[model samples]
Target: MNQLELLRKFTTIVADTSDIDSICKYKPEDATTNPSLILKAVNLHENQKFLNQAVEYAKKKGGSKQEQLLNASDKILVDLGVEILKYIPGYISSEVDARLSFNQDKCIVKAKKIVEMYENQGVSRKRVLIKLAATWECIKAAEELKKDNIFCNLTLLFSFAQARACAESKVFLISPFVGRIYDWYIAQNLMSNFPHNEDPGVISVKKIYNFYKKHNYKTIIMGASFRNVKQILLLSGCDRLTISPLLLKELESNNTVFNRKLIPPTTFIKPPVSLSEEEFRWEHNQDEMAVQKLSEGIRNFGKDQILLEKIISKLM
Candidate 1:
């Protein structure tokens, strides 16, 4: 079997894109979309119609061009997501505003609103997973949403404490970022003599995954934001992985053997301990990498989202 087939035996592979065509081709069990993916898709040659239609819809909404553009862009995002869901059996993740990452109530309200938009178009709650930053407030927001039967995918996670908090709160899924971790290590010139199988991001996710497996937490661990095939291969046996289409294609073409490289929680090299809110906060504060990445990821997404909104305004 190819690497993709081998990995599938032990892990769920999810497509990380907003392109329904690509999702249908790969037939990923699930798919994830963010402003970055959506923005990229709408700009692609084949996705122009979708973007044009969104602009036209905004014009017909009978508002100022700017308001129409914003409405249309969000509508297009929801529409594309709903379309993608039609092809996959599992849930499709749609993100909330990164600006609301720190506001529990706002995150809950926006998540509910996004779900409602999907429901309005006849999409079921079981087929949608709301995406949020792995902030304390977002975790609390996810708790509230889960109570209402809404699943969540906590994105931008880069630390053990974030995973622990999510697992403890019983959130549906956690996406511990891999690429951003590699990016940090490279930026710090630590990759020159980097040790194989001991990647910083891979290690972080392993720590989180072992914790979940040991505790039997229902929250699934999804290693996301991959930098290359090496990281993906190292995490072949993870609960799930959200990989870009390019990486997915690479895995499919490479005829290399792949196996579950992870040792289960029982083989852990460290003891476990439960964390209180204060403890979680302190641990997160101590992890300079997570602290910096979480802030940078949020800022970048927020900036992109703003730029997207500006594009909408011009189209209006």
Candidate 2:
């Protein structure tokens, strides 16, 4: 088998784009979409129909033009998700607005609205995971959502504190960005060696994986935002790995010997410790890399969201 197929034997592969063709091409177990990916898919001529469908739904539903456009933007995500679900048996991540990331009540409200949208189209809540930012407020929002049996994938995750807080909140899963973490260190000139095993990004994921396993948190560790194939290879045996189509294509062609790296420990290390808001903030801030990357990621996603609204406005 090629590396992609081989990797799938141990880890659940999730497609990280909104492109249905790529998801069909890679055939991942699950797929995720963000404002950036939705915007990319919106701009594609081949996928123009889905965008139009969203726009129509928004207009028919009716509201102020601004509200209509926001509904249209969200519908675009759910519309693609509905299509992606037809191909993948597992969950499809429909993200809450990043602008709601810092508001507990607003995040909860947005998440519920996204879930409601998916259900309106005959998609079950079980097959949809609300993707939210990893801020403390969002985590708390996820905690509330979980109580109602709505699962979530905490995104833009960068530090142990974030992972631990998610665990404490009993979130369904998390997407710890490997490439973004590596990029931060590179920007700071902190890398001298590039050994696959010693890779900072790989190391960060491993730490979170080991901790979750040791503590037996039910939350799945999904390694995401990989910079290269080596990062994916090193994160072998993670609960899941969301890969982009470009890298998925690269993995599909390579035939190489590889081994599972993240073996869950049988012995319980300790009960998972909880993180208070202050504790979460302090611990997360201690890691300069995590702090910078988390803010940067939110800003980037927010920018794409605005651009997506602009795209919708032009069509209206």
Candidate 3:
């Protein structure tokens, strides 16, 4: 078997794309989309219908031009999500508008709206994991949403503080960005050439996975934003991994033996104490890399979301 097949035996594979054709080709158990991926999907000729659906939904919903644009933008995400869900048996992570990442109430409201749009199209909320920034407010928003049976995937997680908070909040999953973390270190003069298993991103996810397992946290640790196939291979036994189609294609062609590098801790490890919001902010701020990356990730997501809205605006 190719590495992808071998790895699937131990880990759940999630496709990280909004292009339904690629999702169909990879046949990932679940799929995830962000503003950037959704923007890319909007450019796909085949996904044009979803854009039209968004416009129509926005028309019927009826609002001011800006509000209508916002509605249409969100509609595109759910419209695409509903389409992606038809192929995957598990959840489809459609992100809440990243612009609302810092506002807990707004994030919660938008998340519910996204789920409502999905339900309107005959999809259940159970299969949709709303993606949000791992900001304190966003995590709290997720905490509340979970009570309403809306599962969340906390994205842009870089520090242990974010992971710990999400786990304590009983979120459905946390996507620790492997490649972005590695990129931050590289910018700080860390060497790019290293053994795959020893990569810092791999090490970060492994640490989180082991800690979560040792303490028995139910929140799934999915390694995301991989830089290469090796990074994905190193995280072989993680709960789930959302990989891009390019890397997925690479793994499918290679015959490298997949090894289970990360495993749940067997020897008892001490569980770290939970963090209060103030404490969480303090701890997260101390990690310079995490602070910079979290901000950068949010800005990038917000920027891409704007670009997506611009596309929708043209159609309007």
Candidate 4:
């Protein structure tokens, strides 16, 4: 069997894209879409209809350009997400505004609004997973959303504190970004000396996994943004891994034994000493790489979201 088939034995592979056509080709169990991916996908000629529909819908809404366009963009994203769900048995993740990455109340309101939009269109709440940034405020917002039976997928996670907070909040799932972590090491020129099995990203996820597994936290762990098939294979036995279709094809083309590496036994080391809010703040403040990267990721996503909204306005 190809490596994809082998990995499927231990990990659920999810397509991390807004391109439903590509997803249909590879047949991932579930799919995930973010503002960046949605913006990228809607730019294609084949995907133009998705954007055109948003424009038409926004025009019909007849509101201020900013308001109508953002509303329509969100609607377009939801529509495509609903369509994606038709092929996969698992849930489809639709992210909220990355601008709300730091706003607790706003995040809660937007998350509920997205859920209601999906419900209004006949998509059951259970089939839709709301993706939010893994910030302290977002985790608190998730705590509220969870109370109402709404599930969440925390994204942009780069450290253990974010993951721990999500677990403490009882969120449904967490998408710790493996590729971004790799990018951090590359930027630091630490790649040559980077340890594969216990790389920073792997170590971060392992801590989160052990915390959940040891304390019996129900929040699922789904590693995202993988740079290579090696990272995917290293994270074997993770609840899920959201991989781009390119890497999925690579795994399928390679014939080899895909080892199950991320088991509970590997976490024999005790979870990192727990930290209070103040201590967490201090620790995060000390890790310039984590702090800078987290801020950069949020800012980049926010910028793309705004750009998408602007494009919608022009088309309308």
Candidate 5:
């Protein structure tokens, strides 16, 4: 069996892309998209139709310039998600605006709007995972959304504190970014070349996986942002892995003997105490890598979202 097939025996493979052709080719169990990916897709000629539809809908819906822009942005995101969902059998994550990361109420409102837009298009809420930053406010917002049967994927997670909060909130899943974490360490010269087993990013996800499995927490751990196949191989038995199509193609072509590196332990262990808002903030602040990466991720996503909106504005 190829590496991708072998890995599927232990982990649920998720395609991390906005390109329809890639998603169709890989057939990932689920699909995930963010502002950045959506922006990339919208620029493609094939996806411009969705952009035109969203802009036209926004113009017809008629509101203030700001409101129209917001509507067009959300519409385009949901439209793209709707199209992706048609190809995958499982969930497709649609991210809330990165600008709402720090605002609990705004995050909740935007998430609901995204879901409602999906529903209006005859898509089921069960097939959509509202993606939010792992801010304390967003976590709190997720807690509320879960009550309404609206599941969420807590993303941009870097520190254990973020994971802890998401787990405590009983979110459906948390995406601990492997590649971003690895990138931060490498850029800081904190570590040089290392074997796959010892990769810092892999180590972080393993720790979170162990903590969840040990405590019997139901929250799922999906490792994301992999820089290489080795990083993905290291977390073979993680609950799920959202991989880019580039890496997916690599796995598909390579027929290697992939071994399961992580498994849930049968014996239960005491979990760490839940963190309060203040405690969560302080812990996040202390982790230099997490702090820097989370901020940078949000900024980059926000910038892409603005660029996407500019494209829509041009069409309007």
Candidate 6:
């Protein structure tokens, strides 16, 4: 079997794209999209119809200019998510605006709005995972959402603090970004000494995975943002892996055998040390790479979100 097929034996493969064709082609168990991916999709010829429909719907709502723009952006994201959902059998993650990363109340409201939009279009809440940045407030928001039967996928997670808090909150899933972690280390000239298995990004996910499994935490770890096939191959037994189309194609064509690199340990480790809000903040503050990348990821996503609104406004 090709590596993709082999990897499936031990892990759930999720596509990380907004392109309908790619999602259909790879047939991932679940799919994820962010503002950046949706922004790219809206500009594509084949996806223009969806974009136009959202804009038209927003226009008819007859709100203030800013409100209309925000409405259109949300509608476009859900419309794209709705389309991707038709092609996959499992969940499709729809992210809240990254701008709301710091406010628990706003994050909760937006997450509910996205879920309400999906439900209004006849989709079940179980079919969606509201994606949020792993800020302490966002984690708190996710904890509350879980009570309402709204599952969440905490994205842009980088440090053990983020992972620990998400697990403690009982989030449905957490996407620890592997490529972004690798990028930070490479920028610091620290990856030259590491092999594929020892890659910093890979190591980050493995640590999170082991922590989750060793403690038997129900929160799922879905490794995301892979830079190469080796990263994906090395993390073969994660709960889930959200892979981009380019790497998915590479795995599909290569018939290399991939061993399961992560599993629940025979002896579970003691539960992770707990952290209060102050401690969480301090721990996150100490990780220079995590702090920088988390800030950068939110800023980058927020920028794309604004750009997406601009495109919708022009179309309107």
lDDT of each: 0.86, 0.91, 0.90, 0.83, 0.92, 0.92
* lDDT tens readout by residue for model 6, 1-316: 9999999999999999988788889989999999889888888888888878888888888789998898888898898888889999999999999999999999999999999999999999999999999999999999999999999999999999999999988899999999999999999998777864588989999999888888989999999999999999889989999999999999999996767888777776678567899999999999999999999999999999999988887877
TM-score for predicted model 4 compared with the true structure = 0.92
Clashes of each: 0, 0, 0, 0, 0, 0
**Global local distance difference test of model 2:** 0.91
Please identify model 6 stretches exceeding 4 Å from their true place: 193-197, 267-273
> Which digits, one per residue and each the tens of the lDDT, describe model 2 over residues 191-217?
876664588989999999988898888
Better of 2 and 4 by TM-score: 2
Please give the distance, in angstroms, between residue 174's alpha carbon in candidate 5 and its true position after superposition.
0.6
What lDDT does candidate 5 reach at residue 79?
Answer: 92
Once model 1 is optimally superposed onto the true structure by TM-score, how far is the C-alpha of residue 207 displaced, in angstroms?
0.8
The residue ranges of model 4 lying beyond 4 angstroms of the native Cα positions read 196-198, 265-276
Lowest summed lDDT over 10 consecutive residues: which window, candidate 5? 188-197
Task: List, residue by residue over 1-316, the lDDT tens digit for candidate 5.
Answer: 8999999999999999998899889899999999889888888888878878888889998999878988999998899999999999999999999999999999888888889999999999999999999989999999999998899999999999999899988999999999999999888887756663588999999999988999999999999999999999999999999999999999999997967999899899776778899999998999999999999999999999889878877878
Question: Candidate 1's residue-wise lDDT over 1-316, tens digit each?
Answer: 7778888888898999887777888889999998888877777788767777778767777687656766677677788888898899998999888989999998998788778878999999889999999999999899899999999999999888898889888899999999999899889888877676588888888888777777678899999999899999898789899999899889889888866887566543343566787998999999898999999999988887887777666655
Report each candidate's C-alpha RMSD, comma-separated, in the order given: 2.7, 1.3, 1.6, 2.4, 1.2, 1.3
Stretches of model 3 off by over 4 angstroms after superposition: 192-197, 266-270
* Residues 108-199 of candidate 4: C-alpha lDDT, one tens digit per residue: 99888888888988999898899998878888888899898899999988877777777767789999888888789888988778555667
Candidate 1: lDDT of 122?
99
Q: Is candidate 1 or candidate 2 better by lDDT?
A: 2
